[model samples]
Structure formats: C-alpha cells, structure tokens
Target chain A: MDTNDYIVQVQDLYYRYDKENVLENINLSIKKGSFLAIVGPNGSGKSTLLKLMLGLIKPQQGLIRLFGQDINKFKEQHKIGFVSQKANSFNTGFPATVFEVVASGLTKKLGLFNFLRKTDHVKIKQAIESVGMGKFLDRNIGELSGGQQQRVFIARALVSEPELLILDEPTVGVDVQNVNSFYGMLETLNKEKGITLLLVTHDIGTISEKVTNVACLNKNMHFHGSAEEFEQLKINDVSEIYGHDVHVLTHDHHHHGGGHLHD
Target chain B: MISGLLQYEFLQNAFLTGMIIGVIAPLLGVFIVVRRLSLIADALSHVTLAGIAASLLLEKKFMIFSGLNPLYMGMAFSVGGSLFIEKLRTVYKHYQELAIPIILSGGIGLGVIFISLADGFNTDLFSYLFGSVSAVSRADLWTILIISILVIALVVLLYKELFLLSFDEEYARATGIAAKTLHFIFIIMVALVIAASMRIVGILLVSSLMTLPVAASIRFAKGFKQTIFFSILFGEVSVLGGLFLSYYLDLAPGGTIVMIAVLILVLAIWLKKRAATRSI
Candidate 1:
C-alpha cells in the first residue's frame, strides 16, 4: 500500500478499561486527504477508538500505524493535530490571548528551549486568520464567545500545519445555527490544504453532507463505507448497534453532541 | 526612604533584594496561580521553615556549621519538598490535589518538631518567621541575586513549554512534550522562588507574594503576558511600599508586603466590578 493511502490504520486493536472489553478486534483506516466522520451512540466506543489511534492509551493486543509508522514509534506527532472534547472545558479565566493559544500548537515543531520566532509568529497569525479570528488576536480567550473560543482551539491545532486533523465533538459548545458554517471552514481546510480530517461527532444529520466517508463504530467497526452508502443504512441496523431505536436524518434539531434523538 | 539607600548598608541590602524578588515571585506565580497549584508554594515555604529551624539549631550545636545562612538550607528543603510533592501527586494519581495537604502538614509537623527541639522561637527564628529589614546581610543579598538570575533564566528558556503545560497537560503530553520533566523543573523553580522570597516575606507570608499579585492580575489582565506583567508590577509596588513602611514604622517586612498585596487584590476586584457594571 502507498504511504499516502492510509494515514491511520488500526488492525486487531483491543482495549479494556477495567475488565470487559471497550474495543474488541476493531480494524479501521483513515484514508489520506479524505474527510471521515466516526459516528456512534454515547457508549459506542468512538472516543476509545480515537484514543487508541492517538497513542494516548496503549492497546492490549493490536497494532496502530500512523503515516506508515507504528504509532508507538511515530516521532512525527506534529503531523497529527487533535482538537479534543475538553477544548470547551478550558478554564474560562485562563489569561492567554488567541495568538498565545495558537502559538502553543507549534510547541511540538519548535522543540524545547526554542522561543517563538518572528516566522513562528507569522504562522500563528496565519492560523488565527485561517479560523477567521484575526481581529481577536490580542483578546483574552475567556473574552471570546464559545464558538469563537472553539475556533481559536481549532486554530491552535491547525498552527502546526498537520497532515491529519482529528476532532472529538468539535461542535459541543458551538451554537446551533453556526454549526454548519463551522464545518464549512473545516471542509475548506481539507480541500484547500489537503489535510485529512477525522471527526468523532454525533451531528450525523448536520455533517452528512460535508463528510466524504462515515465509520459507524460500536465496540467493533459496524460500518465503514462512503457517506452516500451510510445514508442508505437501514434504521433498524443502527438501532441494533445502539441497543435501541436510532432515527438517523430525522431532522434532529438538538444542537449538543450528547443528543440521543431516537424513538 | 530614598535617602536610606545612600546611608545604611542593611537598608540597601533589603531594598535591592526585594526589587529582584518582586520580579520573579509573581512571574513564577502566574503559572502557579493558573495551574491552581498555589498551595504548593505555601507547602514549600513551610518546609523551608523546617530547613531554617534545623540550620539555626545546627549553627547553635555545631561550630563548623556556624556563620552559614539558613536560607541556603531553606532553599534545599524547598526544592526537596517540591520533588516530594511531585512524587505524591503521581502516587495518588486520582486525588492529585491531595498532594498539597499531605506535604503541607508533613512540613508543618517537621517544622514544629525542629522548632521545639531548638527550644522554641528565638530572636533569629522570629525574624525568619516575620521578615526583618535590619537583619538582611550582604551575603543574603548576593545569594538572592544569584537565585533570581537562575530562576529568571530557566523561566525565560522554558516559557512556552511551561505555558502549554499549565494551559493543557493532556495536549502537551500528546504533542510529545515531556510533561513530567517540564513539570518537575517548573516546581523546582517554584521552590526556589519560595525559598528566595522567604527571607524578605518570611516563610508564613511567602505564599502571598507568589499568589496575591497573580490573583489580582488575573482579574483584569487581558493575556498571559499582561497578567505576568501586572503580577510583577503589583509585586514590586507591594515590596517597595512595604519595605519603606517597615523601615520607618518598625513593622515586620513580611506582614507589610502581604497586606499591600491584599489591598491591590481588593482594589482590582472593585475596579473590575465597576468596569463590568459600567459596560452593562
């Protein structure tokens, strides 16, 4: 397989939190430059899979490869940018500016003992501008709206110019009306920058039109196919995985990520 | 006060030492306050008391250890306390904040024992507990100057790493930043600042210098850099003002400095509330 074909490939991955298996024999691949959304119910192991892929938690049995290198040995962590669910949970009283927060993304690239140079400042400026937060560079992060703060976080992850971007419920604190525009910016980043975007979200209805592929995960990989094929999934099939009725594309108006819109 | 610098060596010593510490205490305090580890400074200062009391006792018991400054031993104990706090944090992984009280009580317990063994608070110990402006020696000033240079250098070199670690530990670790090592160095810096500050601020009041200005700065400052700047500014005002007042009034330097910092905090909160209401 080509190096650019699969940015992340997990084979026979198994992880156990306490006793029972949280993720069992899960095999998934994120194609390079493709926008993939991993959709699942609350306890469907979507986060565990993301963690396994991110090398945060070690798997008991299996292999995870990133950019053709094993995740444990992968030294180019700068190539994989992550925007976590806790992005909104940051201290509202933190006294960092947008520029300072975004400048932190270059920590991996800048290495230790190296201060942020003028060139790094340009990159930081470009990232804040990319997220359309140029005007708020000097403003405290706590001063921005929830949506604006999320944009600064996205800009923080994007400052290093990673090849793959992963986000865990990037729309949690974001407003209902602006979710689409938020994702529209992400799609632009994918198409314009050739960045592979992998998002773990419950906004199946809002994100279906923008994503190139969908991976429905529940303990194991239930479905990994094109977005068009995923939309064609039977309601009962997803209901079985969630252990309840799951109505997909039912015009779910709920703005939050923890929404369980089912019959 | 200005004329005191020209006339007396002890006045010059305390004045110069206070100026340098004013910059570093709150500079490092910004990280400590934001990380919610302000209590660690308190805990470390108490441990520094143990070292001071032990050294003072040793100076009385042993002729060879005489003439040595207790602040040196205090700095060592503070650094040791920092490492122990880090270890306890790792051990109790779930209840990380428990590390503070665990180390804090242990420091006090040890401190009390040493104080008792030394036959309670002597004049020297009393001065250490509540800073003495007239007692600051030339050697103490030089020692503080060197420690301040080291603390400032380490903070400048690792500012970005420390900031990221303070803001988000998980992200810093995910990006392959040595969170443990960086945190280790950070606490050591905190320890040094606490130990260095104890001479002028006293062990009991040292944490105020490390936290009060930071608390005030966070109320109205817009960014981390601005917060740091304001923290240092507040620290300087408190130190200088307190030093001047102590010289004329025969008051304890530590008590005076901390009182001024508390005043700034109150003023900052009042001004911020006023600003918020005006905007609304």
Candidate 2:
C-alpha cells in the first residue's frame, strides 16, 4: 500500500515512565479502513501506544504520523475519534442527556465562541442513530446500562464525523452477554461505515475473529500482520512476548484451559 | 421590603448585586460540582478573606488605602490562590485533592494574621464575614456588575469547551481542545465569581452559594441544560427569599441565604427519594 494510505505510522517509538521503559523500539503503521486490534498482557504498554497515537501523551523518543503528517504538526484532531476506557474514567452520575453528550463531540470542531447550528443538531442525531442510540437521545446518560453508556460514548465520538475511531479497552465494565453485540457494532462501523478502527484490548480470543489485522505488543512490537498470520504464530512466540506460557485454543470453545492474563 | 428596596440606595445595591450573583454562582457551580471541585470554591473564598483582611489592615495603617475597595485586593488574592492551587495540583498529580486543604489552611492562616494585626474583628470586618444588607456600596455594586458581565461572557464563549473539559478531560485534551488554557481561564473565572459574590454571600459562606443550589439541582435534572436551569432557579429563590427575610426579620443575609439553599437541597433529596420509592 502507498504511504499515504496509512492512517497511523509509528517509527522507532520509545516511551519511559521514569527509568523503566514502558515501550521500546516500537514500529507500526495502520492502513486506512483497517480494523486493527492491539493486544497485550497486563502492563504491556498497549494503552500507552494508543495514548501516543491520540496525542494524549508525548513519547520520549520516536516519530508518530497521523494521516501521513507528523503528529506534532497535525491540527485536524476532529478527524480522529477516541473513546478511552469507560470504567473509572467518568463520573457516571453526571447530569447529561445522550444528545448533549454526543453534541459535545463537536466542541473542538465548533471552535472557540461558536455555538451549535441547526445543521449540527441533525448531525448529532445521525451520529447517535449510527451507534444504535437513537431512542436514548433524550434519556439521561447516567440512567443507561454500562453497554448502553458505552454506545452513547461511541456516539459522542462519532458526532465529529471522524475518519478513524480509536478505543482503549472499551469493554471494561460491559456485561459478558452485551460484549458480543458491542463488538458487533464496532465491526459494523469498521466494515460498513469504512472508518479506520484501532482498538486496544486484552480479549485476544474473542476479538481475533472480528479484527482484520492484529498487533501483539509487549514492551515492543512483537508481531504486526494479518489476523490469519497472527493466529498461525507459534504458541512459543506468544509466550515469549507475554513472558509466560500461553496456550491458544483454535475453536469457538468458551474455556481455553489455561491461566490466561486478562487485562 | 419592596418599597425599602427602591427607597434606599444601599438596599438597591445589595439587591442588584445579590440578583446578579444569584444567576452566575449556580451557573458556574454546575460545572464545578460536576468536576468535583466544590471544595476548591471554599478554599478560594478563604483566600479572598485573606485579601479582604489584609486590605482592611492596610486601610487602617495608611489613609491613602482607605479610599480603595477591598474587593479588588480580595479578587487579586483569590485569582492568585487559584493559580497556586493549579500549580500544586500539577506538582502533586497523584494527590491532586491535597491542593484544596493546603490552600484553605494557608488562606485562613494569612487571614488570621491580618485580622489580628488590625486589632481583631471590628464592625467593618463583621460585615465581610457574615454579610450586611446596608454594607454594599454603590461602587461595590459596579464592581460586582463588571465582574458578572465578564464571567457571563466568558461562560457563553467557552461553554462547549468547558462542557467537554468537565465531562472527560483526557478526551478533551486528545481532541486538541487546549485543556490547559481553558482550565486556567475557568479557575480564574471561579475566583472572580467568588470575589464578586463576597459582597452578598460573605467570605465564610460564598462557596455555599456556588455549590448548594447545584447540589439540589443534580437530584432531578435530566440533562446538563436542565441542571443549569434548576441550579439558577434554586439560587434565585435562595437569594431573593433570603434578602427579603433578612430585611423583614433583621437577620444576616448570607446566613439566611445559605439556610434557604440548605432547605432547598433537603427538599430535593426528599423528593428524589420519594420518586425512587414510588418507582420501586
């Protein structure tokens, strides 16, 4: 693929918290319209990599490019929709309707001193509808279930009409039953809406089937390729990256029969 | 009370200032309460007290300073204290809440020093502490008006940015919303509002004006805009009712206003519990 086709590019990225290195010699490039899942064990710098890409934090050393432009120089932030981990990051009791929460997504695009126009209301409604939250537009955000709240947050991110959607451990507090539908919605967004998706998750087993691309990261980029090739990676290679023995089960079985680190 | 409000300039000044603050206090309070920075208002008000006490001492010592309004000095200290709190929050990121107590005690410590230096509490200081209906001068009203206009304008201009920042700060920063700059402006506006509110609410109880109405509003408000509307409504009721009751009953306006707010909050809680039980 051409370099311009890539939505995210990270070269020789290094991040450190004090003296210990969180990520080292990391390199990655995500093509446009690709559903890529970055999976890793606990404390494996998966979220850190997402944060760097979203410009939430600065890397100690490396080059990060968004849409082929240096991240530091990229001003088109509305082009990238980001939903951080839902649990513990927000005050659930905050008084806001789904429409209000989603409308706030256009804040940066609206710029300083600018109020929402009539056209913006239609867009906000459309965004909420896309996330299957059209009925919950007037409902209190705090009153929704965890899965519904997550969907409202996704709608919030989508209201900006972003070309790329990035989520960091998006299903933390979501119920096990709802997790499937949540992933389904994301899959639909990625495939049908054609939005570039970069999800940071630890549910490697369940998410592997939906994602078109996979990047197994632990401190450094261990593997970056098609999901099929990733599934073919030897268990020993995965164990080395996890720093522990991890058994991979190839079927739709619920139990993997191993002590897996779910982070 | 109506006739007295129009007949006396002091009453007019107090009423006008109280009405303006009634609107803006709870307007900004919705954001403050949602952000969980209610204590920051208490801390900043104490800092304003220190400034007021220092100004009183200076006025007693120098004739030239006697002509100056203590509101300006109080506002300066409140703004400075706000900036210091922000700095401390950055310095101790993990223990960010520590900033509130550190500044609160610092404010009281400085205020006590200034008060003692001026030979303890006098009639002038008494009004600043608990608020006096006749204490608000025409000049003080003008100061309050100017600050109210600035605060309202800033809130309108930065409403969307402020909403995003209060909702999810990290997400706001990720979207290049200039979080730091907007936050600085926000805290400074909080300081100004606290300072301006002192003439009606007094230093000791100014934070109650900012928070109590918001606390009540959160119980029933279904959306952000509704919360704002209810907060402002509660605030107006408290201020107007308190002012009228204070005039009729010869009570301290600040105490009366805060007590009214407390009653409203209690009513809201009771109503919310009733609704929940009914639903069950």
What TM-scores do the predictions have?
0.96, 0.97
TM-score of 1: 0.96
TM-score of chain A of 1: 0.93
The 10-residue segment with the lowest total lDDT in model 1 chain B: B113-122
Tens digit of per-residue lDDT, candidate 1, span A198-246: 9998667777788999987778787888999977866666677565667
- DockQ for each of the predicted structures, in order? 0.77, 0.87
- What local lDDT score does residue A178 receive in model 1, on the 0 to 100 scale? 82
User: i-RMS, every candidate?
Assistant: 1.1, 0.7
C-alpha RMSD values across all candidates: 2.1, 1.9
Native-to-model Cα distance after best TM-score fit, residue B144 in candidate 1, in Å: 1.5
lDDT of 1: 0.88
- Candidate 1's C-alpha runs over 4 A off are A87-89, A243-249, A252-263
- Which is the leading candidate under TM-score? 2
Relative to the real complex, the DockQ score for model 1 comes to 0.77
lDDT: worst 10-residue window of model 2 chain A: A254-263
